[model samples]
Structures are given as C-alpha cells and as structure tokens.
Target: MTVERTLHHFPLDPASRQVRLALGEKRVAFHEVAERYWERRPELTRLNPSGMTPVLVETDGGKTLVVCESRAILEHLEEVTPEPELMGRDLAERAETRRLLQWFDRKFDYEVNGLLLHEKMEKRLLGLGAPDPANMRAGREALRAHLGYVEKLLTERDWLNGRRLSLADFAAAANFSVIDYFGDVPWTDFPAARTWYTKIKSRPCFRPLLTDRWPGLAPVAHYDDLDF
Candidate 1:
C-alpha cells in the first residue's frame, strides 16, 4: 500500500487553504484533518508546539513535517514539488516573490486580520470574547489603505510582485477572501485592486478554496462567484 500523507489543517484558515491550493495545483493527494485553531485543538498543539495549522504529517514514515508557519510550509512545498511552479523558477524572481509574500503576510494581515476576523469570527470561535465594534470599524478603515497598495502594484505589473502569479498572489488572495466573507472589503474604492483580485480569485486552483465555509457563518453571495 502507498503510504498516505495527511494534511492536518483547517479548511477555512487562509494560510492552510493556500497549502491546499498549492497541493491541489500539484495534484498531490492527501487526507485532510479539519482542525480549527481558534477552538484550541490539543492535537494541533501537540503536533506543533506553536499550535498552528498546515501541519503535513507523513503518517506512513513517521517523518512528520509540522510546518508551524504558513510561509515555511509554502517554501517546503515549492522545494519538494517543483512542477507547475507557484513560486518563480529562478532564484532572483523567487526572492522578489518571497519579499512580497512576507509583506502581504505581515503588513496586510496585521493591519486587517485581527481587526476584522477577531471582531467578526474569532470571538465566536475563541468562545470567551465579545464582539468589539471598535475593532471592526477600524478594520474597515484599514482596508482602504491596504487596497491602495494592492491597486498600486496591480497598476505597475500584472501581479503583485513579479511578472508571474507567485505565492505572493495566493497569500494576498487568501487574506482578501477572508475579509470579503464579512463583506468588509470596500471594492468600489479600488477598482484596480478589484480587477486584479478578480483574476487571482478566478484561477482554477483557487475555486475549491473559495467555496469553504464555517458552521454558523454563511459567506457572502460573492464568495463562490469567480467573476465577482
């Protein structure tokens, strides 16, 4: 029997979803363990001391690759499976792509993720917090600033960082999809950003990811609409 590699990750997690997209792009078959972190799954904690998702466990060999960070897992996947390259094929292009990936992961996520996700989703999942109206409003405000940056990049190039659609696009697209679920993105304010995102969100590899859902939270009507 061929040993199966199980991916222990939350389907709705932006980063975890990125890994699933990457794997799906590569046509890699693996079992999914739908472990959400906000609920504080002990198994995820044990598997990764940092207690994060996107843990790829090679159950057959006991050679568990617990990727605590999303980017680490992405880098690992690029190294292991080079075909249909998501990151750039050359060293310089890959570096530039990674730079943008970090910028999106850190700058964009920090500015908006906590403010909105915490206010709208995390409180319910964390099971102890209440909705902070202030944070939600602030996140809505921050989206304007972030969208400007995305628009600027799209105006300069076809994609965010390099000429090709690299991991940077996936990273940013995932974050945008998360906020879009709450109907938080001020799309009309940034038509260029909206246009660029339309391309990324419509990619074949990203189709399944956009359909992801949570138990109590119904995604906005545009969630699965590729053109929207």
Candidate 2:
C-alpha cells in the first residue's frame, strides 16, 4: 500500500497557507498536521532539521520522504500531482511562472512582509512587547511603496506576469494579508490590484483564510465578509 502524503504547518503562516491553498486549489487531499512554528517543537525539528513549518512528508515503501522550504515544496507538488497546474506545464511558461513566483516571494517578503508583519503580527505572536510605533509606521510606508509597484505590474498585464493566474497571485495575496492585519493597505490607491485581490480573496479557498485570528488580533470585520 502507498502510504499517505501529509503536510505539517502552522495554520496562520502565509507561506504555510500558500501550500494549503495550493492543496485546496488542486483538490489534493492530504493529512494536515498543525505544527507549532513559534515554539520550538521537537517533533517538527526532528522531521525537518531546519525547524520550518510547511514540511511535506510523503510515505513510500515504508520510508518518509521529507521536503522542506516553500518553493521546493511547490515544485515537488507540481511534479508529483501534475493537476490543476499551479506551475505552468510548458518549459517556457513554467520558467516564466517561476520567475514571477520568485518576484512575488522575494520582493514581497523583503518589502512588505518583514516590513509590516514584523511589526504587527510577529510581536503579538511571539509574545513580545507591545507594537512598535516606529516599526508600524515604517511598515505602512514600505507597504505603500510596494503597493505602487504592484500597481505598475497590474498596469502592464492582468495578472502578475501572464495570461492566467499563477502562484504569483497567491504569493502576493499571502503577503498582503499580513499587512492587511494592520489595515495598512489603502485599497483606493490601486484599483487594479484592489480589484484583483478582491476577486482572489473571494475564492472559496481564500475564505477560510479570512477567518484566521491570533489571540488578540481577529481579522478586520470586512475580511470575512468577502465584499469589502
């Protein structure tokens, strides 16, 4: 018998959620093991020496196939499942999509996620001191600049870089939700991004994400409403 494929991840993590959303999008059923990412879980560290959430464990021939890192997991899924086509199938299209995915992951991580989420969610989740006004302000400023860059991308084409929606959109939205925690995005400033985000957020896979909450930080009221 082929042993099952399972994913161990923290529920609130965007990178982890990106994989979850991919699983949902592809309609791939896998066991979900909620891993404690903030605290150092021994099992998690044992399974993944890097101590990262979003580890994919595939059991085959009585051996555990361990894969760590978000990008690697994504590619592995594309190779093994090959359905619903998160990464484009063709050689050129796949390479281009990977480029855009990296752009979304790297650019968004540096410019938006660390800038905004480091201030708002990280402090709260890590049980550190209260929010830093300076950090919060910095995040807002950085997010606005990044949003403008997103606008530039939107102006050039419909999705991030191609005719169809790719992992780039999911990657971008995953980061945006972190910033949106602080109500940082001025939706009015970028209509194209706003419109595209609204549509993506309205998807069934995205709905559960809207309901996610930290102890003191529930989502903004409009997050779950889907029309906001």
Candidate 3:
C-alpha cells in the first residue's frame, strides 16, 4: 500500500522547515500546503487544535493519520521510515540529538525567535509598526552567543550531535536560515559555524528553503547563494 503524504506549513516557519528537511533527506515524497497560521484559519485549527503549522497528514488507502507540530511530525517520520535515519543510531547519540532539538525549539526560540522574528516578520505580517530596536539588539546578542556555541560544537565534531548528520543539524539550520534571510547572522565572526552552515546549505534538502519568499518580505542578497 502506498502512503500519500501532505504537509501543511508556512514558508518562513522554522518548524515547517524542519519537517521539510527531514522529508527531503529521508527521500520521502509528500505534498506541501502553505498555511498562514497566524490567521488561525478554521481549517487549520481543525487539523491541529493548537493552530500551528507543520502538520503532516498521511493516508494509506482508507486509513489516515494526522501529526501536528514539528516534534511529533519529525518523530513520526523517523518511526515510519527508518531508512536514512535522522535521529542517531545509538542511545547516547539519540539522546544528544533530542537534547539539541529541545534547545533549538525552546531555548533558541525563546531567546532569539520570540524577539527577533516577532519584531521583524510577525510585525510586518500583522501590520504592526516598526521593529523595536532594543528587542533587535537583544536578539542579535543572543544569536551571537548561540553561534559561538555552535562553533564550539563544530570544533569538537563533524556534525552538531556527533559524527553523523542528525535532526539536530536540521533544527539549528532551520532557525539560522530564517535569521540569515534577514541578513542578521554575523557569519564572518563565526568561521567554524559558517563552514558548517556552508556544508549543509549545499545539501539538496536545503535548496527549497533558499528559494522561499513571502509577500512583502525580501531576503538578503546572499540568502540563496550556496557559495555565500
């Protein structure tokens, strides 16, 4: 039985991007449905009561399964399609991968995205006024700290979790890519992190994210440049 898959997501959403990267890396065929989740469309809410993006709906002939949010969807993908696993193989590796996943989804999102994305992308989409300079400054500072941590990790290992590419890489990349779109990442100051990013950016799965553009939002000139 062939399983048909459809993903509901927002173009610039980090969570959505994570799912997309996982699907692409796993070589899974799925359809994309872009959603403006902030609007809280009734249809979207029906799929996921929380009204978040990155919902995955899978149908195998008659039966259907709906997975909501990035974490659940990512775990579901790994469980259903074990080949080319994104989670690490061993227990320690898997634990580290999950820890980083939480770090990005919680700590990173709170310190960085909550302030930066809210001021820049959310405000523009919702027709709010100009970005708060104080918030932007704080976000940038926090981002540099995060990048320094990434550089440290890269110095020790090949990938974020350890030796192999894992979901941790996708999580960090998804968040960084969005910030990079706005030309905010201080890549020049973080050579190791830049090198790591360059390697992932060259991957086939990362190609689609480079091309994502929302109305009224323009990306930095080098956002899509693999060589940049």
Candidate 4:
C-alpha cells in the first residue's frame, strides 16, 4: 500500500531546505507545494495556524497527520524512518547535533539570514524596494563570524557533531545554500568551510536544489558546479 505525502515549502527558505534534505536523504517519496509563505495564504494557516513553511502531511489507511514547522517535521521523519540515522548514534552526539541545529536556526539566522535574505530576497519577493546596503553589510559581516565558527568545528571534527554526518550538517548547509544561491558566500576566503560545503553539495539529494531557479533571478554561475 502506498502512502501519500506532501511537503509545503518555500524554495529559498533555509528551514524548508532542511526538511527537503532530510526527506531526500531518507528516500521518502513526496511531492512539493511551493508556497509563498509570506503571503499568509489560507491553505498554509489551515495546516498550521501560525502559517509556517515546510509543513509535512502524510496520509495512510484513511488517517492523516499534519506536521508543522521544520524541527517537528524533521523529528517526525526520523521517528518514522530510523534507518540511515541522521541524528547520531550516541546520546552526546545527538545532543551536539541538536545544539548546532539550534545555533544555525536561531542565532545564525538572526544575525545573518535576517539581514541578508529578508532584506534582499524576501523584500524583492514581496514587491518591496531594493535591499538596504546597511543590512547587506551587516549580513556579510555576521556571515564571516558564523563561517569562522564552522571552520573551527570542521578543523576539529569530520562533521559538525562528530565523525558521522548528522542533522547538524544538513541544518548548517541548508542555511549556507541560500546565501550561496546569491553568490553571497565568498568561498575563496573561507577554504575550510568551502571544502565542507563541497562534500555536501555532491550528494544526490542536493541535485534538485542545484536546479532551482528563481523567476527573474538566476543563481551564481558556479552554484550547480560540484567541483566549485
């Protein structure tokens, strides 16, 4: 018996991207509904009263479950599909993975994506004027600090949490992918971070994202390049 699964997501959203990556890695079959969440659509609110993106809906045996928010969706996926575990093997590693996931989702997002994506991409999508130069400058500056922290972590461990690739890597890479789409990431200046990202970019799950094209805006030339 086949189940029906659907993911409502915003293409460039980092959290949304995380869910997509998790689904792809788990090899779960799902179709996507691209929602401009900023518009506050009725369909979005019906699934999640708060109207957040990356909502996952699963239907099986006449039962329907709606999972809202990226974190919950991720945990639900892990619970339903335990093989090829992405959280981690041990307690400590799982804790660390959650820690880094929070770091990127909350702290890094506030300092970087809030300024960069919201000021530029979000604004443009909403028919707002050009991005604020001040915001862009601040975003770039904060990005340096975040990338430096990631570089330090990579230097000590193979993956963000430890030896194995875990949810932490997907969380961090998801955020970086959005910035990379705009050519905002200066890879040359951050060699270690670049190398780490290259490994993630080569995965089969990442191919769909590489082909993502925003209406009037194209990604950077090397956005799809694995050797980049």
Cα shift from native, residue 47, model 4 (Å): 0.5
lDDT of 2 by residue, 20-120 (tens): 77777777778988776778799899887889888988898868788887788888888887887877656766787788678767876776677568767
lDDT of 1 by residue, 1-228 (tens): 455677888776777877877877777778888887766688888878878787887544654455566888787778877887888867987887888788777777787886887778877877757888888788888878888888888888877766887888888888888888878888878998888888877777787777778898888997788777
* Candidate 4 to truth, TM: 0.98
Report the candidate with higher lDDT, 2 versus 3: 3
Whose lDDT is higher: candidate 2's or candidate 4's? Answer: 4
- Model 2's alpha-carbon lDDT is 0.77
Ranked by lDDT from best down, the candidates are 3, 4, 1, 2
Give the TM-scores of the predictions, in the order they appear: 0.90, 0.90, 0.99, 0.98
lDDT of 3 by residue, 1-228 (tens): 999999999989999999999999998999989999999999999999999998999999999999999999999999999989899989999999999999999999999999999999999999899999999999999999999999999999999999999999999999999999999999999999999999999999999899999988999999999888
Worst 10 residues of 3 by lDDT: 207-216
lDDT of 4 by residue, 141-165 (tens): 9999999999999999999999999
Error of 1 at 153 (Å): 0.5
| RMSD each, Å | 2.0, 2.0, 0.6, 0.9
Taken over the whole model, the C-alpha lDDT of each candidate is 0.79, 0.77, 0.95, 0.92
Model 3 steric clash pairs: none
Q: Backbone clashes in each candidate structure, one number apiece? A: 0, 0, 0, 0
Give candidate 4's error at residue 60 in angstroms. 0.5
The better-scoring model by TM-score among 3 and 4 is: 3
